[model samples]
Target: MRNHTALTTFILLGLTQDPQLQIFLFIFLFTTYILSITGNLTIITLTIVDLHLKTPMYFFLQNFSFLEISFTTACVPRFLYSISTGDRTISYNACAIQLFFTDLFGVTEFFLLAIMSYDRYVAICKPLHYMTIMNNKVCQNMILCCWTASLVVIVPPLCLGLNLEFCDTNIIDHFLCDANPILKISCSDTWLIEQMVIGSAVLTFITTLLCVALSYIYIIRTITRFPSAQQKKKAFSTCSSHVIVVSITYGSCIFIYVKPSAKEDMTINKSVSVLISSISPMLNPFIYTLRNKQVKQAFNDTVKKLVFLLKK
Candidate 1:
């Protein structure tokens, strides 16, 4: 076994090594980070303050927005700093913490999205029983379950990664200490580690995908039963936004994690990973608010109330 005590830090070969490209990246990602934080916070705030948004859907949305904020915060700030200062090194401890929390939040968000889909499914498909089915108690339990599952699923592998000695190259190819990149740098034979990671990933992917798929199946079937053109249109519109968001998030995740490894695949994989991590947060607010008339109105009302209070 390698001497773990000797290694103090690991270098991160972030998105790009080019100085000029770094400047461009700093500008672009900084903007994205700001927007993601702002948009998600706004959604959470509106959901909390608006009486109309007190329903189960918005309740889950509030949690999703909070998770997005945390997910983005875990990596984007460090990435932006690295790009600007040209410091691509993270302490070993910091990297492990980052890796743990990133996976924790990411996995939590995946389950949260599934929960949201279930909320939508209940609301759209079983409107009469929606309130009875997804009451405050149920909502709280679901959120708790999502968070608990994330922590449980992430902790063991993270502990394993932390225990492994890093005696080889200390430089991670990606911006963050993602499991794949971190495993590559370990001096130990990571075959078992690799298998563990793949197993965990496959399990998560299958479970989340199944939940989303089943929710959509029921949603589609429910929507088809609507006889009126207006009812059909409204149902379709409501479900379409959720479907798109779920598809994009789940599709990109599957592609990046499950594909055959290749040299050329790295660029696209990194790009897609960045897109899913960075851009998806911004999309949640837009998707939830823009697609639903009630949410938009509540958001506007909340903003107006804030403005009026400021004026007062």
Candidate 2:
């Protein structure tokens, strides 16, 4: 029974033990991280620079992009650094820091998705009131409230690790510091913490998901009522990307965290975590922007500006 201070540095087992695979992983993940940053940055830039995108939807889109960037930046860079250097030791404080930001960004994202769904609902179902409902102040307040709520929600379970005495078993069998992996390494009884974390995840998912589902239910019902097929198709087209992103993000989150035990098989869990922390961020920008004519036009406009500047 000792303080966590004595066990300051814990060894991260990372995703693989093979030296050859580690190098290969470094290359793959490094590229993914770069792409994630660039893609998210493009979204933010377009949202900021394009006057046509000055709607509540794009406002929330930019915020979501920022979260994706921050989310991956928190975990992937550290994971890449550890894998590349073959030095997998992380300080207790650093590990805790990573877990905190990961949890923060995750819950915030949940709320943002719900908000995004509601924005779509207002736009489609109550078009006349959309502007009134999602004004700038209203949007800002919603984000602030969600972030604050996330902070409050995580405190009860986060204390589990904050007060832990990690005197034994310094090996974390994952690529980065996360709640489950950190709890697995602790010598203390983690049953309560595990329960709380799982509970929080499930509860949050159900509530926020319900909001999104209801929004969609109303949205779909209203779309079906549209007088013309083309009008209904246009509405669905606008929403399809959001639904895809939400389904992937929410589905992956539930699979990773809804388990009874945090100590799920390391191999599978690490792969899942990589998908969430590394691949998802990169995937989101593409999902939102690939077929988006507005974004393509924005990109072309920006390029022309750059070319014109060089000529000067």
Candidate 3:
């Protein structure tokens, strides 16, 4: 972390300049942030306490909920503060830290989702060996690999960003400190850093997406071969929640990061990003709980236990 940049503080322009809009955004974001935290935390708590959820699938779901919480926490609260207090300036180091964490959590999530897909594949395609193959130890190691892989992808570009000289301008277009907006303000040569960022994004996206795609392919093929229609329905139901999440995660990201026309609509991109960080996290818990019988049952059971204790 070298202090080579001339400008130490960058002003974020935020989503809009209207006072009315800012108030609306603040209220909206705060509500969603609270909901996101509560939802993900509920999932985490349920996974921890419910014996019925003591499966490899719920293990990954627990971690995914954690990642969603972490990812949203990285940016949402700060933006909310800025909106309410009318202070949009973030120090250079603070901006860098935010960028690093957001990327770390975001990248790790892609891998985690892929891992979840593989878990589903194993459960459906190779049920007899699922327990042995995806034991607790293996799940823990796979999560560690997700973090390690994310670091490998993000660290190089960030190190290069340290050498960026922000003498030109300090006003960022987006609500939060993100890679592209920061790079746009730098006076130094950003070609290499930009390339590396693109490479990292592509690598994470392609590799994880391929894993998810292949896993589902095999899963679908195996499910189709099952003799009983009831078996097929149950198998698909087990995977539907994960598939919906994967689609939303990948689709929004591809629109923002991989689309050729992304640069043309920065405002739209930022708005879509808000949905990704805030709305998506808030929605995931409901998606899982509503679609999953085991989770709903566990929640009901837990509620009953709490009610019984309260009565005593």
Candidate 4:
């Protein structure tokens, strides 16, 4: 088959074809996206306003919340609109933009978490030098590197997709402009791009995951060496929460992405995608705040001031 001209618009097959479930999906996703935005915003506000959270860890966290808000915004709103309006057609350019930003945010989130893990490790394993190691300028540079690296890592696959031959088949079998779904519609042999995507996914996910894992290994070992049971508990408590959040995020992603097939089962892939794109971002705020005593105290303090101002 000869290569074909580029198509103008692509129809997203969306999450489902079930007319009966469209309204329900719309409401559920709409509520979830709203909550994701609200929760992440609260975290950001508290982190910025409260002096208690003026450390490097929370500095990183503020950026993390901003990233999560971006991650959720990139896909959920468009997906929700598609579900509600029954208009699944997306311009090729729009799809390309979505693919790039979502992947950029997704990749950066992974690296940020890794850097945060190192932050925790330094904070715990070398409390005397946390500030010296993770100073303001250094922290700023680390964050800059994460965003820059995300852009660097996503360019190749995006360029590949942009130059693809669609052969007039413009229906994407997923909600957003996912790589696998886009590849399936292209007339060109996608073997090289597929390999590149897989390589990139594996490289990004696994390397960050290993960094996180290695940091925690040292953290766990150090905490276990503490002389007092109370000290041991406090140390583990800090890192454990991060580990849990990371585990849930990376675990779900590995299940979905690191596979032989782009999507072995659309239903399973979609379910896992929802976990990554919607549930995880929504849950991160709670995961981070509910477990951290400093954040809780900051929240209480912020509330007290607001209430006092209102009464006056």
Worst 10 residues of 1 by lDDT: 258-267
lDDT of 4 by residue, 1-312 (tens): 123564778898877788778877888888889889999999999999998899999999999999999998998999988887788999877888898889999999999999999999999899999999999999999999999888888898778777788775888888898888788777777888888888888999988989998998898888888999999988877877688888898899888778775635576777788888888888999988889999999999999999999999
Each model's lDDT: 0.81, 0.88, 0.90, 0.86
Residue 143, model 2: lDDT of 86
lDDT of 3 by residue, 7-36 (tens): 678899999999999998989999999999
TM-score of each: 0.94, 0.96, 0.97, 0.96
Runs of candidate 2 exceeding 4 Å displacement? 1-5
Write one digit per residue (lDDT tens) for candidate 2, span 1-312: 137367777788888789888888889899999999999999999899988888999999999999999999999999888877778899878887888899999899999999999999999999999899899999999889889878987878887567777765888888888888878877788899899998899988998999999999999999999999999988998999999999999988898899989666767778888999989999999998875777778878988998999999
As for TM-score, the candidate ahead, 1 or 2, is 2
Candidate 3: segments with Cα more than 4 A from true spot: 1-5, 259-265
Q: Which candidate achieves the best lDDT against the true structure?
A: 3
Task: Give the better candidate number (3 or 4) by lDDT.
Answer: 3
lDDT winner between candidates 2 and 4? 2
lDDT, model 2, position 85: 75
Summarize candidate 1's per-residue lDDT along 198-237 as a digit string, tens digits.
Answer: 6777788889888988998998898888889899899888
